[model samples]
Target: MRVVIAGGHGKIALLLARSLTSAGDEVAALIRNPEHAADVRAAGAEPILFDVENTATDRLLAVVTGSDAVVFAAGAGQGSGVARKYTVDSGGSVRLAEAAEQVGTQRFLQISTMGAGQPPARGSDKVWAAYIDAKTQAENDLRARNLNWTILRPGRLIDTAGTGLVTLAPPPVGRGDVPRADVAAVLTALLPAAHTFGMTVELVSGSTPISQAIAQLSD
Candidate 1:
């Protein structure tokens, strides 16, 4: 399958690209920085330079054209401010979904925060408030699109190695941490899962094997 990933230079995106490529799938990474081309290439993905934050939706058509799926994995980065959250995370996500629909791409995947649907209370912090609001708004917008969408809301993301296991389900759980590589693994595992469509899965580190966990997903 041909997959297009926004924010292809991101850690998770890069890991996902490698996994997809290793599985013999055609992978394309959409990135804003040309300097990151080599890094994306090293991961065995074709890199497409595009700026979803500033570019028109039409400008993204070529990237998603004929692709099997579109993954909205872009973010404003760690040190970015509140405004950037709305632009890159919120606006970029909505635009990716819009572009996917416009290009007739049927599958859309989104990487979201664990508590976005019900963000934590951060009193008086405009930046945190904006971030949560952006994620919440983006998720809502994606749900309204005419596509097979799967939203993975992961717990605190860590840089530890993957355990090849995870706890995937609907909400009502407390906080926890999940390795970035594990998240990427789950993302790859769900790539062709029709059962994951229309599902917003909550993920965290656990003892269940990836395959076993994904197998329990309800249609």
Candidate 2:
């Protein structure tokens, strides 16, 4: 399969690209920084320099055209301010979805976060609130589209090595930390799952192996 990943330079995106390529699938990663090209290429993906935040929808459409699937992994980054949360996380996702819809791309996997639609806790900083709000909007927008979309909301992300085991279920899967590698593993597993269409799942470390966890979701 050929897949296009927005924010191709992200940790999860890079891991995912490598995993897919190792499996003999083609990956095109959209990145804004020209300097990140070598890194993305090193991960076995063709790097397409496109900034989801400022690029036109038609331009994005060109990038997504003829792709089997699209994954939205772009973000405003840790040091970015509140406004960017909306522009990059929420707006970028909408732009990609519009392009996917126009091109008749059927499969879209959105990388979201836990607590996306829930009310922000008291004492939460403005940026944290904005991040959650942005993800919420993105999830809502994807759900409203006619595409075959699956939203994976993973719990607090850690950089530890993946265990290949996880708890995947429709929400209130509760709070926990999951390795970025494990999250990538789950995303890879979800690509060909027809039963995951329209499903929104939360992931965190647990006993079930990745394949078994995914199969249980279908069951």
Candidate 3:
């Protein structure tokens, strides 16, 4: 399978790319920084320089065309301010979905956060609130599109090594921490799963193996 990942340089994205490429699948990562090209390439993915925040949809279309799937992993990142939360998180996700629709790439996987659809609590930090709101809009927008979309909302992400085990279920899966590598493992399993279409699931560390967890989704 050929996959296109937005935010290619991200921790999860790089892990996913390496796993996919090692399995003999083709992977192209959309990266904004030219300097990140070597890192993406080292992970065994072809890095396409495209900024999801500043680029046009038509341009994204060219990059997404002919790919088997598109993964929306882009984020505004820490200290980027509130406005960018909407532009990069929500807006970038929608742009990828639009391009995927136009090119007939039916499989679209989005990496979201656990609190996406829920409103922020009273007196929450403005940026945190905006991030959640942006993700909520992204999820809503993807649901409205004519595409096979799966949103994976992982809990507090840690950089620890993956355990290859997780609890995958629709909300409320409750709060917990998950290794970023484990989330990438789950995405690799879900990429070609037709049964996962239209599903919104949450992830965190647990006993079930990654493949078994995904398979159980259909059972």
Candidate 4:
């Protein structure tokens, strides 16, 4: 499969790229910085430099043209201000979806957050609320697009070893944490699974076996 990943240099994106490429999938990553080109190439994927917040759709469409799928894996860094949350998270996602539609890419895997699609609890940290809202808007945009879209909203991302264990359900109140490696594993597995097509699933890691979790999701 020719897979294009937006924000290919992101932490999780990088992990996903390596996983996909290692599996013999042809991968192209849309990166914002030329400096990261080598990093992406090192992962066995081609890198196209384009700023998600500034790039036009026509150009982006060309980049993804003829690809089998596109993944919205870009993110505004934590140090960025609140405004960038919307610009990079929500706006970038919408733009990528539009471009994919223009180029006839049918499969889209959106890397969203678990808290998205739900209002934050009252008195929640305002900063965190804003971030979640940004992600929610992005998910909503993709959900409305014309394509086979699968929105995977994972819980708090922990950079742990890939245990290959996970849990998937509707928004869970307190059980939201998954290792980056496990998340990448899920993305790679779901790429070809018809069961996940057009599904918006909330995911997290618990004690369940990774293969079992993936099997359940694919079922």
Candidate 5:
């Protein structure tokens, strides 16, 4: 399968690219920086320089053209302002979904946050709370698209080693943290499942094995 991953420079994105490449699937990553090209290539993916936050629809469509799947994995960095959060997280996600549909890419996956369905609580001072708000909107927008879409809302992402164990369900229950590598494994595992189509499930680490973890969501 040929996969196009947005935000290819991200930590989780790199992990996913490596896993997919090792499995012999064709991988093309859309990276914003020229420096990320080497890193992405080192992971066995062809890096296409394109910023989701700035690229035109035609440019975005070109990147996804003839691809088997489009993965919206882009995001504003932690230190970014709230406005940038909306532009990169929300606007970029929606645009990626739109471009995927326009280019006839059938499979779409969004890497979203765990608390996406809920509103911000009082006294929350993250300043970037808008990031959560934006993610929520982007997920909803993609869900309404014509393509077969699956949104994986993983919890606080840790850089720890991958246990390859995870939990998955509708939402609210799978609201704990998990290793980024584990999330990448689950994403790849979902590639061949028809049941995961049109679903937006939440994910986190649990006692379940990797295969079972993916089965829980795809089922």
Candidate 6:
């Protein structure tokens, strides 16, 4: 399969790209920085210099045209202010979904934050409120589209090695942390499964096998 990742330079995206390449699949890593090209290529994928925050939808379609699927791993990054939260997260995701639909890309996967749908307490940090607003809006936009979309909301992300185990469930769960590698593992495992279509999954590190945890989500 040929897959395009929006935030190809991100830790999880790089892990996913390497995993796909190791599985003998083609990967197109969409990166905004030209300097990240070598790093993406080192991850066993070709890097396409494209900025989701500034690129037009038509241009994005051109980049993703002929790809088997797309993954929205792009983010405004940690410590970014409110305006960018909308521009790069919510706005970026909606634009990609629109471009994906126009280009006939059938599958799109979203990497979202866990507290998105359920925003933090009122008068919380304005930036965080905006972040949740962006993420929630992005999720809503995907659900409104006529596309095969899966949203994965992972808790606080850590850089530890994957344990190959996790807790996968629906929303309103206790907060926790999961290794970025395990999140990538879950994303890969769900790609080929039909049941995951239109599903919003919540994930955190745990003891269940990745496959088993995914199946349990369906049950």
Best by lDDT: 2
The estimated TM-scores of all candidates read 0.96, 0.99, 0.98, 0.93, 0.96, 0.97
For model 6, residues 1-219, the per-residue Cα lDDT tens digits are 999899899999999999999999999999988999999999999999999898777788898899888899999998899999999899989998998898899899999999888767778899999999899999999999998999999999999999998889887767899999999999898787778899998999888999999888777
Candidate 2 wrong stretches, greater than 4 Å: none
For model 1 the TM-score comes to: 0.96
Where is model 5 more than 4 Å wrong at Cα? Answer: none
Provide C-alpha RMSD values for all models, in order: 1.2, 0.6, 0.7, 1.6, 1.3, 1.0
The CA lDDT at 132 in model 6 is: 93
Model 3, position 104: C-alpha lDDT score:
97
**lDDT by residue for model 1 (120-209), tens:** 596747787788889999999999989999999989999999999888887754679999999999999988999889988999999899
Model 6: per-residue Cα lDDT at residue 146: 90
Q: After superposition, how far is residue 10 of candidate 3 from its true place, in Å?
A: 0.4
Residue runs of model 6 more than 4 Å from their true location after superposition? none
Candidate 2 clash pair list: none
- Misplaced by over 4 Å in model 1 are 122-124
- lDDT digits (tens) for residues 1-111 of candidate 2: 999999999999999999999999999999999999999999999999998988877788888999999999999999999999999999999999989999999999999
Local lDDT at 158 for model 1 = 96
Of 2 and 4, the candidate ranking higher by lDDT: 2
> How high is the CA lDDT of each candidate model?
0.90, 0.96, 0.95, 0.85, 0.86, 0.91
Q: For model 2, what is the error of residue 27's alpha carbon versus the real structure, in angstroms, after optimal superposition? A: 0.6
* lDDT by residue for model 3 (121-185), tens: 88999999999999999999999999999999999999999999899998899899999999999
lDDT at 44, model 1: 97
- As for candidate 5, its clashing pairs are none
Q: Which stretches of candidate 4 lie over 4 Å from their true place?
A: none
Evaluate candidate 6 by giving its C-alpha RMSD to the native, one decimal: 1.0
Could you tell me how far off, in angstroms, the CA of residue 14 lies in candidate 2 after the best superposition? 0.3
Task: Supply the global lDDT for candidate 1.
Answer: 0.90
